[model samples]
Target: MKPNASSVSVVRSVTRSAIRDVTRHLRGVGLRAAPLALALTFAASGGLRSAHAQSAQTAPAGQPSKAARDEAATRFKKGIDLFKETDYAAALVEFRRAYELAPTWQVLYNIGQVQFQLQDYAGALPTLERYLSEGGRQVPAARRTEVEADIQTLKGRIAFLDVTVNVADADIAVDDTTVGTSPLSKPVTVNAGRRRVAVSREGYTPQSRVVEVASGDTVKASFDLVERGANAASTAGSSGDTGSGDSSVPQTGTGSTSGGSGDSGSNVPWIGWGVTGGLAAGAVVFGVLALGASSDLQDLRGTRGVAASDLQDASSKATTMSVVCDALTGAALIAGGISLYFTLRTPPSDSAASAPRTRPSQATRAPRATWSSASRPQSSGPELQIGISPRGAQVIGSF
Candidate 1:
């Protein structure tokens, strides 16, 4: 009368499914039972150890195959060892696997302990509560009270974020660290303080919010991400995913150019080149004036019976013009040097340098639009609050 292999497999599948449903129901509010709570749950249904005994008494030996039970026990042992080693993450995985096979409260307890050890208090709270609820008589009344008290104390230090997200499978991040996907099982627990929450998904704009929560308070942060204005025309031309197809990208180059030095450089730096050209022109003009005044002086001195006053006047004029010419020449040289330096030092904005280059794709692709992200609190209760954006620099520019 022993149950066959097929029957045992069927029982395990059914039990796993039932347990999963129960787990999901318990977690509908966003938490789960403690790892050890499985012991009580299993015991209430004729404790996990009593499972085979009940099966044997009802029918025959090996009702639930010994090998299967032994494997579950082995997994549980490994989980315990991992927990002792302070490898809480590994322990949780092992305990979960054991629960899948046997679905014991003890495994749940272990999982909860690991979560707590890992400082995932928000995740741990629900599981521990579940353990207590189902622990029933298996947990001593005094012990249950102690655990419940602990749960209450833990709640005081934690704040809850009940997030509402529109996009399915969108990742949610708390304080820049990815927490989980959207449609959370329950409110995410975090330390009381200012927290940043964000949600993102493909083909949709990312949404984020900042909120301040006092200890024991619950806040709402909801995300309704918008779909991108996907355009194939834009994607084909974009160097990166963010490129606007209609916009012409600046080509990068090296060295600088000045007026009349045409390599298709737009926006002539008149402030630099104009000064250089003007100073050079002034020097030439002054030199010509000085030479003419000196020539007049020579003519006045060479003329027979030339007046001393006329000669003296021409000499003084020549001297004055020469000094002015020399001063201008020096000024021109200095001005020219400064202009050359500035013209050669083209700012990066004007220079097309060895910037990262992107190629236009021939294949049709979706073009992104000017995307703006906003969030609000989606709540049915009075505690529901709107999304609070963190203080940030405002970027304003023309397209």
Candidate 2:
């Protein structure tokens, strides 16, 4: 309800008296100009809203009033004073209050500056961006350039996180702030240093990790969630731990054992290459042996004194060696090609296929069986089969 003109005058008189009291208190507090400044701020803010409205019956309500602007200015001044005193926390509160009342681009600039001083770089970045974009014409080009440069510096001290959960639609969060439900389309940019990551899905044990990242780095974390059970975990990848797995089994390769799969694992490719080299060496040895044998056979055939039966025997031995050499060479080529393929190809990720295998229940386990030496397949020690009949003893190959 609108106040009567007589009531407005009385309120104005009270406001004027209060301003005087505040001014005297400020002067006594040793800030000489504070009282006068505050009085001017209050008076310029149109004294009291109700009192002003009584005098200006035609004033519009939609537009911002002179009183609000004055109050915002007062808050801005107080924030500056607190900032000079190095009380950044108090300054931040005052700056925020000013911004709330005014919401001008200049007020946003002050808020961003205060947040930066408080070491809340993440909060400051967006605020500064808003200042540059919305207050471009109001601010000088040099000021905008400085803020953009500051933003770049801030980003340098920031990092990002990209999380992958084995279970689809699992809820995910970073630093206690919800990014969204997985799988996230992009990584979340955050301040540098240690950060907490969490993922949750109904019917499955939740997974979390604390990751430390340097400035400008992007870290990817995957969660191979386990179902809820007595053996299931309540947490994973805890501080100083390398992974988020329930099993304590030692990691055998560089590839992840969680929600993602690796290409043949880190060791497999190297092992394959080693095998390839070994096979190639074997092939070379065999080829050299075959060539030596062929030369010997040629020499034997060229000799005029050699017996025909002797020559035939040497020729047969040379032919067998040559065939073996060819086989070994072919084997080397095949193995090397496979190794090369593995080294070059990017392995497709298979979250399920890479999961740990559970042991069979005692009741469902296969029964143990034993076989006699003569009946069992020849796959034991030495990889060679040897037997002696009544006729004689002879050496034999495993094949």
Candidate 3:
């Protein structure tokens, strides 16, 4: 259904009243230009388009249902009443709702005026710009000229803040008022003045900085928030130490004795055993080569076409390889015996010996403790091994 002529007249009258209100407000604020002339021209040319007319022109048929137009008209009327009453904050909300319902450019003008009344220069600038953009040729030349002048004026009172926060999703605020959340896609607009910018996130210490900016100036702010309790241990460690590098500190615990001694002595057994295993592998390899050479030499002695020099060479190769194999086997045995001895013996008591004599200062004590509990392998008393012998390709150990 279409709105009747009387209803359209009412919408236009209400729009004219809003324009008059904005003109008076601008004059009261001492704006250089008298907006009254533009306001009159705006009404004479054409005031607000009725919601039905706007929806029909902007969208295809049947869009912006009757219910939506009715709602928008109702909100528009309420916003006008609120604006007259000087309840600008509420009026701004109502006008914005009407805009969402219908998106008529007339509503943007009212929204911009209300934002100006609220001292939100940053908000008003963009709202007026959008009004001009959406209205385009529909906005009278006089109205366009006046709005452009206001835009220039607004730019003088607005400043830009480029905020960079290290943490994502952190809340950003200007002068205790929330602006946006990180990471902001663009620089935030703020009123020109001394402003406090803050960035905060959960589990991190909030950071804030004060900056002064003049009209039309852009400023940069950065925040690198530290996680809570990150430096607590380090702080304690630094404060605990006096200027002196060495200080007598008391040590009490079973940890000191076992920790230092076990760490220093534990690697010896593993090293010896690793060497023994490698040497045994070499012995096996050489033993196999020696057997092959000896077999070749024996076969050559019986072969009819074999030369005497070939026999001598094969024999010499077999003898040399056998000697090397025996040497490696003997080294393996010696290494194995040493590994067993080190594994079975108790760790040296160097840390234990030093621990009892006036405790090492807090600075020095951590290394020994860390070495004992964390660095060394865990075990009970070492197990003793009696013998290790190679039979064929395998070496057997008796415990």
Question: Can you give the TM-score per candidate against the true fold?
Answer: 0.44, 0.39, 0.49
User: 238-280 in candidate 1: lDDT tens per residue?
Assistant: 6564454324444333223222234323323355567757877
Candidate numbers, best TM-score first, in rank order: 3, 1, 2
Q: Candidate 3: give the clashing pairs.
A: 259-372
Candidate 1 regions off by >4 Å? 1-68, 166-186, 191-196, 208-212, 230-399
Model 3, stretches more than 4 Å misplaced? 1-64, 229-399
Q: Which stretches of candidate 2 lie over 4 Å from their true place?
A: 1-78, 97-101, 166-172, 177-185, 200-205, 224-399
Q: Clash pairs of candidate 2?
A: 45-67
Looking at candidate 1, the ten consecutive residues that score lowest on lDDT are 379-388
Residue lDDT tens for model 2, 1-399: 466678667756755665565456445544333323333334334444443564454335664455565577678667756755667799789878866765566667667766776777877888889988887686677777778888998887778888889879999988888878988898877788999999998888888889998878899988998888633333342532644353455443323432333433455679888887888888888888888988999999888999999899888888888888777766666566555544544333454335444452532342222336674544342222333456533433332
On lDDT, the candidate that comes out on top is: 3
lDDT of each: 0.62, 0.66, 0.73
lDDT of 3 by residue, 1-399 (tens): 466788777766765666677567656655422333343333322333444456455545855654676677678767756765678799889878877876667667778867887888998999999989998998879888988988998998999999998889999999899988999999999999998998999988898989998888889898898887776766777767742333333344344444655676688789999999999999999999999999999899989988889989999999999999999998898788777666666453556545454434542442221123453534454434344346423323323
